[model samples]
Target chain A: MMNRDELRTALIEEITRVAPDLSADEITEEASLRDDYDLDSMDSFNLASAIHKRLGVNIPETDFARLQSLAQLMTYLEKHPA
Target chain B: MSDFLMPSLGADMDEAVLVEWQVKAGDAVHRGDVIAVVETAKGAIEVEVFEEGVVEELYVPVDTTVPVGSPIARLATQASVTPASHTPAEPEAAPNASVEADWQPEPSARPALEVSARTEKNDRISQTPTTPPERLKASPLARQRAARTGQSLADVTGSGPQGAILAGDLTSAAPQAPAAAEPKGKKSHAGFNPAEMRKAIAAAMARSKREIPHYYLATAVDMLTATHWLEAYNADQPPEKRLLMSALIFKAVAKVLRDFPEMNGYFQEGTYQPSPSVNLGIAINLRSAGLITPALMDADKLDLAQLMTNLQDLTRRARQGGLRSSEMTRGTITITALGERGVDSVYGVIYPPQVAILGFGKVSSRPWAIGDALAARPVMQATLAADHRVSDGHRGGLFLDRINQTLQDPEQLNQPAHQESES
Candidate 1:
């Protein structure tokens, strides 16, 4: 029942929660999480965990590459809404 | 009553400034309670008590720099036995942080990092001790700033908790001081001052090189089976549940240490004392501070999942400066993995008291042969730097071989480790 923008906002909030050192503005929609924000494996894991916990969507390891960027992740989430 | 001494964090650490007392008199402290926070060359570390008892007296006041093994506090225990017993208590099976989520910061739960800026205005600055070897309660950043500006930390009054000088305190203390115009040679990298940290590291490494007679060993571990097993295991799970290469490496190193006890303990005073449990010292580097080797208690016993969780928790806490005294001091053996950063191999200097250090390089695809057929396989070079006084190159080579053999069978690692009783 959540909109795309709402999901994105929720995702950013979760990222901010896990990594307080990062600001919302720095997390771009199109840019890769690793290249833009230096999101390491642990950071990415925490982000995926937040998304899964919030959206109730089980993002498998194989699909991690698809969720590299915020836009890509949003698209994936929208295609398979929880 | 047993005296809780200021533990020696490392060989280079001669003394540490007691930052704040987490426990006061009459407080019933558990075996693993963080009694106080002490500031060393590596930064502020939470000191944990080993005995279950009530705190009798805080012998050393806050902000006092005391020597190693010097009693900082006295604990009233049930029985006055094992006077020199600083060994950590047996850890709980699974460290369920959720069960104790709402636990207050009274040193009972895991000692977390004191990163939150305390705005409590210090009223006891007026009672600053006017001693000769003048010690100041200042943050590492503040100390670096003072050194750079050529201003002494003692002159600036602190606004932080218990009158500890924060970086913000320095700016307000002397805004237009003559020192700012002429900067000292103290270097800083990306807002992180590493000059003092670098010096500390140098001293530790120097002492390690001087005292410990080291023997080197390296082996190319074929991690193809392990890598494939991990991939298959991780493919079905979420990102959070996925196992890291280091986790497997840690398990392998720990499991192998059981057979080769000589390489898994403290070497001191012309004698080597082997520890009953394998508490692996994981060397973690901090941006603000230097290197710290905190233990992942009973590493040989933990499964891959538990090891992963513990590793994640330990690394996170260590970087945040939330390390317990037991974790900081009770390392049976040390492991340094630089594979993630693209390093092919690492020859680490052994953290003294500990006999061996295991280093793992990057896992890369290389031409591997099975009898006659050649195929590309993921290969990793694991190096072992051991104290020659306790172990020779033959034993060191065998230890590396055991690690390689253990890693070959990933299913063995994933299996529920048999419950081993601690001595």
Candidate 2:
């Protein structure tokens, strides 16, 4: 199991993989990936799947919309322990 | 037995430099093998061979700039057909890294951008050559860097095979050039120069508008049924397997194209040739480079899931510079969809040799009329920019409307598409 710091790093990696134009320096923990970074619907879906593949977490459609921010995504991952 | 020539990437390209050889002499290769990587104005493209054979000889050395259709290699397809093809079949003797790099096209030939004339266009580039023009041997990389750093090739001495100039030669000769001053990481981040790419795109668009008489049409599609269907369809699927709404749009357009053959093929030399298959050129935006619209070949044939997989694979490979020659050139028509983050509607300029281009904009919540009452619903704006010589506004309108109608029956999209007019 990855610790808190490692989990945050993994999530950011997934985000950048989808949105190559985005950088780690500009991303804030509480900011929305779509609202802040301009990731489209397909990009968002790809990010979700990429995260699922990397961390072994299955994100449901209802919960995907809720986990828009890094903090929310990390917290959900920690709770689920996937 | 046969000479494998350098292929022209598309109407946008003139020539390419052999970047590297993936297969050497004596190597057995099958059809669709990526035997070489060549760099064009649009970064490196993996060159795939169509014939199954043994590599008999490597003619062009790595880093040598060869014209489109120039013989780059010799393949032994049949043992009896090789006429004095005796080159010892030795891989080590073949030009690897240190070949004559100073292969440059004559100044006049380099500037011959003959994309405007209507007669014998793309075929002219591939057919019989009128004596390979006198060339000043210089690697394309060195030439581009030389132009960037204001270093003239005439002044530089070549150390490569046959005294041809190479990229390494430029840095050592002109230590003060900006190409040397830049940090290592920054150079890669600055992918194939965007300024040059912009120039190429601008020229193509300008020529397309100048030469092709275009008629435009747009329609607003209500996605209440389609979006709901997509949502329901994806509800049971995992994240990896879930399909994008655009994939459905691709499948729908491909299906509707069968009924409207006029809007689904190429137009050149005062003739409209409707292709036997629907090769939808999809515009994929690259983070490093500008944009490339390679074909999602035979988009009309694949089911939703297979189409989704190909689209995703094409997108990934396109970004990574792993595209084939046919995908780069043989697109019957093009579809440009501005993703969810883009504007409400898009009107595209038709890619040349192709008669029509379809554009899709972001799906937004708009006031839609249901019976006498009006309510907000998910709506997408679809537009068509087609050649006036080939298709009329009436045909274009029906084409757009069919796409909208096809989306209303999303379940039908999951089933196999009946192959149409093209063989």
Candidate 3:
């Protein structure tokens, strides 16, 4: 199980992997990376899949849109640790 | 000995810079092996060699710009006696009635002679070049497999011909085939410039509107039953294996397209030629920057799950690069879905040469008439922008209606589509 700090690092890495254009260090805690960077539904799905593969958390398709920011993702990951 | 020439990925491509070689001189290669990766305006396309042979010599080195039809490599095939066998007269491929019209010369496309002349003019572009140390010796499938997983290649041993790592070896690279195929080391290649992409899009779209006379049509499909079917179907499946509402829509479109052949083919050389099979192109937008449509081969033949998987793979590759030449060039027809983000419906511009473009808007629960009383049902807006040269409103109308009717009985589409889709 990853600690909160480890979770943050892992989450950012997965996000960066899904959208390789972005630098992992620049992903802010509260920024809605989804809206800010124009990551579409497909992008959201890829991000969710990446997180699932890397961290073992399967984000349901219905909840794909709601995953807006890195902070929100962290909270969800902490709540449902693999 | 035969020459492997650079294929024109699309109409806009006049020349491309050879990015890297997946093969080397004196190396043996099979037909369908990726010999090189060429950087076009469409991005890096892993060009496949179509004949089995030993690599005699690689003429164009990496980073050299070469015209279409220029021989990049010389292959001593089964017919060739020696590496010095006289160069055979370049064969002319007749536009086949069965497959692949995307790379074939359309009305505005240049003739073979001109392409050959251009190839000769660019001969000076190549400098003293050799296969780089960074080039991987693995098969195309194996390289793709390696890239997708971010699995380190340092430890994997090659066991195939010339010790090339095969796809089977990567299976032990566990938790493989993850849906996110956004490959590692993506930073090595320069990103597709948004400005250049916009310019390319502008050229294609402008040419489409100016050359082809287009007819537009729209209909609202009550996806109530389809949505329900998808929900119930996905409930039992794993997250990665689940199907989306778009999959149902795509299946419906591909299935329905078969019934209206004129609406599912290319309008090239002042004539409309219906494709023998359905290569349903999906217009995928890259951020807000630009668009690329990579087709799913035999879309109608794929069941719901298969269709969904293919779509996912196609979009992932489209957004991240690694789109093959055939995938980028061929589009017997295209479907653009803009509904998810915000739009109620999209009336897309017909991607040139291909006679039709289907658009779907967001499926929303709206009040609809069921015999007498109005009930809340999921309704999706569907629009068709088709070539006036090939199909009129009558056939186009019937096509959209068939999609509506097909979605009403999603179970029929779920069955294994063993029946051939008549183009």
**In terms of lDDT, which candidate is strongest?**
2
- The fraction of reference interface contacts (C-alpha pairs within 8 A across chains A and B) present in each candidate is 0.42, 0.39, 0.21
Worst 10 residues of 1 chain A by lDDT: A16-25
Candidate 3, residue B141: how far the Cα is off, in Å: 21
List of clashing residue pairs for candidate 1: none
Off by over 4 Å in 2: A20-23, A35-38, B78-191, B416-423
Best by DockQ: 2
**Tens digits of per-residue lDDT for model 3, B286-387:** 653367788897898897888988888887777656777667666688899998777898998887778899999998989999999999988899999899
Better of 2 and 3 by lDDT: 2
Cα miss at B217, model 3 (Å)? 0.4
Error of 2 at B190 (Å): 12
Cα lDDT tens digits, model 2, B111-175, are: 22222222211222223323322333444345556656877666665544344454556666676
TM-score, one value per model: 0.74, 0.75, 0.76
Candidate 1: CAPRI quality band? acceptable
Better of 1 and 3 by DockQ: 1
The Cα local distance difference test for each model comes to 0.69, 0.70, 0.68
List DockQ, one per candidate, in order.
Answer: 0.24, 0.25, 0.21
Top candidate by TM-score: 3
Every prediction: chain A TM-score: 0.90, 0.94, 0.88
